[model samples]
Each structure stands twice: as structure tokens, then as C-alpha cells.
Target: MTAGETLRGLLELTRPVNVIAASVLTGIGAFVAGGVTSHPVEVVAAVVATGLAVGAGNAINDYFDREIDRINQPQRAIPRGAVSPRGALLFSAALFAGAIGFALVLPRLALAIAGINLLALVAYTELFKGLPGLGNALVAYLVGSTFLFGAAAVGEIGPAAVLFLLAGVATLTREIIKDVEDLEGDREEGLRTLPIAIGERPALWVATALLVAAVLASPLPYVLEEFGAIYLAAVLPANAIMLYAAYESFSDPTAGQSRLKYGMFLAAVAFVLGRAVEVVGAA
Candidate 1:
């Protein structure tokens, strides 16, 4: 392969956007969970560890989903023959090791979160993707747990639980929408996702209900006085995004559900802004 193709393939396997999101989520978690570290070095270490672990999960997920990707995503690194399966596995292992190694030096809390989350990452890619409700639930927890994991890295974050629940509900809602969109692809692999288990309309309804739950819960931080008025600056828009996501899910637009990915990111941004304001207001 050409050098450019090789480089692109490697990056594709890691899903850099997702990795960056994980790190960003970690930072938000760390900051809200405690106050981002007093030491910038520790903050860097935490983000690096979270990013590596996220990369490890993505690489291995591609390796395992190679056959599936060959049908659904023919241009992926493995499907395009840009990277060998064994090579991908090795990359995943190296990334996982680096993540854990980096966390080991940070703090005991980081170490524990790293190890448990790594295991969950492996299980998610390997075992859970094929299951139905359980898999969807796992993905939600895994995604939302990044918040808690980030919080744990710094110190005991009192408000982290509410954040976890809010994110988790939104994630589950998003995953269900994706399942409805991927009905044919998943059927080809004989995977029993929510849409396959029930029906598309029912699944969409479930997703819409969950989205409503998220919308209702989004105001909790402000209601509880965790964040200041500045948080509303970002969160209000994010809530609007979630509201649109609910409508989209209900309408079942032909396009697959990728829009909410950014919407979730926006919500995280709100949290970060709100948390910063909270700290500043307190100080």
C-alpha cells in the first residue's frame, strides 16, 4: 500500500474522532468529577490513558468486525486490506497496554478505572455487539462510564452520578436509533438488535421516550445548582439538539443516525462549560 493509504488506514482503524471524544469526555469528567488536575501533567496523562484505551477498543472492534465491515463498510482498513487482522490485534494490545501503563503512574483511582474499563471495552467489541437489549445497554453504560471514569481519575466527584445517568440515557437512545437504521445490515450478520427483536416502530418509540427522559433530566445540574447561568449558554442549545434528535427518531428519516453523535458532543461541551462556571462561581 502507498504510504498515504497506510497512514489513513491506521488512523481509520483507531477512529481518531472517537478517541478524541473519549479524551474530551475524560477531561470533562475529570474537571467536573474533581477539578481537572492541579497538575497539567496529570491531566495530560489521564487524557492519554483514556484515548489509548478508546483506541484499543476501536482497533480490536475493527479486527473482529472485519467480516461485517466487508459487507457494510468495504473501505474500512481490514476490509480494504490496508491492515492485517493480526496486525490490528497487535495494535490494539499495544494501545491497551499503553493506556494501562500510563494510568498506573497517575493514581490508584485511575488505575482501577483503566483496568475495569479496558475489560469492558474488550467485552463490548467481542461479546456484546451481537446481543440484543443487553448489548445496547452495555454500549450506553460503556459510553457514559467514560464520564465517571474521568471523574474517578481526579478524585471523588459528587455530581458525577447525575452526569452519568444523563449521558447514559442519551447514549441508549442513540444506540437504539442506530439499530433501527441498521436493520438490514444487522440481519445479514444474524445479530438480534432491538429493532430486529421487536419492530422498527416500537424501537423508535422506545428511543423517543428515552430521548424525552434525557431532555427532562438535562436541567438537573442547573436545578441542583451544580452549574451556573453560563452553563445554560451551551446546554440550552444541546437540549434543542436532543429535541431534534427525538423528532428525527420518531420520523425515522431514511438517512442513518449519525447526527446525534455531534449532538452528544455538544452536550458534553455544555457540561464542561457549566462545570467551569460552577467552579469559578464557587471560588
Candidate 2:
């Protein structure tokens, strides 16, 4: 392939946006937990490992879902013939191994986290993606792990762990909304997504409920001595925005652009708000 095509292939393999979001959440969690180590080398290694692990998961997911992508995301690298399935699979394997190797340089907890994330990725992509309900939960868990991985790297599971868990819950709600948005494509491909199995309205309701739960939970840390006023101030508005988006998603399940963009925005805000909580708490 030409250089440009190769670059695009790599980008597709890496799922750059997801990796960045994951890495940023890790950094934000670490920063908040007062866990920023002076060991730049170790931090760099841990970050790289996180990226590789996320990349590997994306690549492997593409490999396993090549046929599904053919219908839902035909222009993707594997479906569009820009990259062969075997190439993607091998690339994924390499990244997984590289991630584990780099994680080994950090504390044993980081290594263990990497290993668990890798395994979870495999399970999610290979077995859970087509299952109802479980797929959404699995993706949420993986997203949540970014924070836990960071906390583990810093050798503390304290407030960051709870924040990460909350983040995961919010993400799970978003995942359900995404499923509703893609119901037609998923049904066409025989994928048993929650929206497809339960019908869009019920699925949307579940997503909305989850979003409400997240919004309610957003301020609890600050309220119960887990965080301070700054976290409360920063996160409350963001949570309101997320709740608005989730409410809109329920009202307009077919609004694909609205769901995709706004759902993503909510997820981004969750990470930002959580980090804000951490930073304020540290202060």
C-alpha cells in the first residue's frame, strides 16, 4: 500500500480517538489522585502500554467484526480492502504483546491491569459483541478500566477507583444509546444488540435511566466528603448537559447524528468532570 493508505490503515487499526480518550482519562485520573510520579520513564511506558492495549482491542474487534462492518461501516479499512484481516489480526497480536511488555516495566498492578484489559477485550470482541445487554456492559467495563489502570500504576485504588467506576456507568448508558442509534444496521447483520432485541423504546428508556443515575451520582463524591466544591461546580453542569442529551436520545432514537455526536460529547464531559473532581480533591 501507498504511504497515505498505510497511514489510514494504521489509524483505523489504532482507533485513534478511542485511544486518546482512554489515555486522557488515565492521565486525568492519575493527576486527580495525586499520583503523578516523578518517574517520567515509567509514566511514559504505562501510557504507551495503555495505547497499545486499546489499539490491539480495536484491531482485533475490527478483525472479528469484518463482516458486520461490511454492512454498517463499509468504508472501514478491513471492509474496504485497505487492510487485510490477517494483517489486522497480526497487528493486534503485536500490539497486545507490546502492551504487556511495557506494562511489565511498571508496578505489578499495572501489568495485571493490562493483562485483564487485554483478556476483557478479547472476550468483548469475540464473544460478547453479538450478545444482548452484555455487549454494552462489556464495553463500559473496558472504558472504565482506563482509570483503574492509571490508579493501579500509582499504587492506590482510592477515590479514583470510585470515579472510574462512575465513569464506566455513564459510558454504559451511552453504549446503550449507541445501540439504539444503530439498531437497523445491527438487525440487518443479525447482531443482537440491546436495541435490536428489546426494541428501541425500551432500550432507550434503559439508556435514559442510566444517564439519570450518572447525573445523580455525579455530585455524590463532592457531597459526601469524597471531593470539594470545585468538582461539584465543574461536574454538575456537565452532568446537566449529559442528561439533556440522553433525554433527547430518548425522544429521537433515529437521530443518528444527534446520538453519535452528543453521546460522545457526554462521555468526554464525564472524563473531564471526573478529572476535575480529582484535581480539586487533591488541592
Candidate 3:
């Protein structure tokens, strides 16, 4: 392969979008904890650590899944020969090292969270990915922990707690939907995902119920005065989109999951906006 192809493949292994999103979530956590200005260095460390960790996780997952990708995702970097499995593994190891280096400078709680997350990331594809519901829960926890990691870095995790729950539940719902979307491939691979353990429709129902609970509780931040009215306004639309996506998943899991991601992104934006409004109001 050409140098350009190799570079692209390496980047693809990192799943750059996910890395960026996870870093952003970490920043949101720090911002919500009211530490962005007061603890700028720690915030940067937390965000960088989160991005590196996520990149490492994705690269390693692709490495472990190279064989499965051949059947389910032939165009993936390793399966397509754009990147070798050994190269992916090495790259992931380097990323994990960088994540640890950054995380080590943070406070005790943040370091602890990072250590657990790094271990979880390394073990996910090999140990948990095939289990029914357990894999989804692990992935969800990883996603939600970014917020707590960021908050803990600044010595305050109180505000990020609600965000963690909201994000985790939403992620769990989406993970289940994704499993339903990949039911055929997972079945061929002998994987026992939630959708495989239960029926696809039933899995979607569980996903929908979980999302509904999250939607109902989305207003808690504003109600508790953790955020301002602007947060409520912004989150309402996000909640609506998510609810609609959950409803749509029954008919088209692929589209529904895609839309659900958009909704989740919107909700994250709402958190930032809400926090910003509160800061401005106080000013």
C-alpha cells in the first residue's frame, strides 16, 4: 500500500470521530464541574487522556476483530490490508501509553478512573464483547466514565454525576439498537449480544424503555438548579429526538441508531449550553 493509504488506515483504526467525541465529553464534564477556567491544566490532561484512551480502545478492538471484519466489514483497515494487525496492535499500545502518561498527572480519583478504563478497554473485545448485555454495559460505563474522570480531575464530581447517568443510559440504549442492527453478523460469529439473547424486537423494547426513562429524567438538572432554563429548552428537543429514534428503531434499527446518535450529540450540546447559560447568569 502507498504511504497515504497506510496513514489513512492508521487513522481509521483510531476511529477519529469517536476519539474526538469522547474528548469532548470529558471537557463537558470538566466544564460542568465549573473548573474549566480554574483548573485549565487538569482539564487539558483529562481531555487528552480520554481521547488517547478512546483511540487506543478502538485500534485494539479493530486488531482483535480483524478476522470478524473480514466477514462483516471487509473494508475495514486490517481486513482490507490497509493496515496490518501487528501495526494496529503496536499503535494501540503507544496510544495507551500516552493516555496513562497524561492520566498519571491527575488527582487520585481521576487516575483511578483512568486505570480502570484502560484495563476495561484492553479487555473489552477479548473478554466481554461476546457476552449478552454485559458487553453493552461495559461499553456504556466506559463512555459515561469520561465525565466522571474529567470532574474528578478537578476534585469535584458532583455536577458530572447526573451527566454520567444520562449519557450511560442513552449509550446503553444505542448499544442494544446497534446489536439488533448487527444481529445477522453477530449470529454468524456466534456472539450472544442482548438482541441475540432476547429477540430483536424485545431488545429494542428494552432499549426504548431505557431511553424513555432517560428522557423523563433529562430535566432533573434544570429542576435541581444545576442548570438554567436554557438547558431545559435545549434538552427538550434532544429528548424528543431520542424518543422518536427509540420508536423508530422497531422498524429500522440502522436508521434509528444513527438518529439516536444525533440525538445524543444534541443532548451533549445541551449540557454545554446549559452550563454556559448558568455561568453567564451568575456573571
lDDT, candidate 3, 134-252, per-residue tens: 89989999998998888999988865887787788889999999999989988987889999898998899988888888788888888888888888898899988888988988999
Ten residues in a row with the worst lDDT in model 2?
A: 256-265
Candidate models: Cα lDDT each: 0.79, 0.74, 0.90
Indicate which candidate wins on TM-score. 3
- TM-score of model 3 relative to the true fold? 0.91
Q: Give the alpha carbon lDDT tens digit for every residue of 1-283 in model 1.
A: 8878876887888899999988988778888765564646667788899899988999999988899789889989999988889988999999999998878766677677678889888988678877777788887887888788777766666566667777887788888888887789888878899889988888888877877777778777788887777766787787787668767776663432566766777888888888777667668
How many clashing pairs in candidate 2?
0
In model 2, the runs with Cα more than 4 Å from the true position are 2-4, 37-39, 70-74, 224-226, 254-283
- On lDDT, who's better, 1 or 2? 1
- Estimated TM-score per prediction? 0.86, 0.84, 0.91
lDDT of 3: 0.90
Index of the highest-lDDT prediction: 3
Where in model 3 is the C-alpha error above 4 Å? 1-5, 80-82
Better of 2 and 3 by TM-score: 3
For candidate 2, lDDT tens digit of each residue in 36-114? 7545566667778888889999999899989978987898999888888988889899999999888888778877878
Clashes by residue pair, model 1:
none
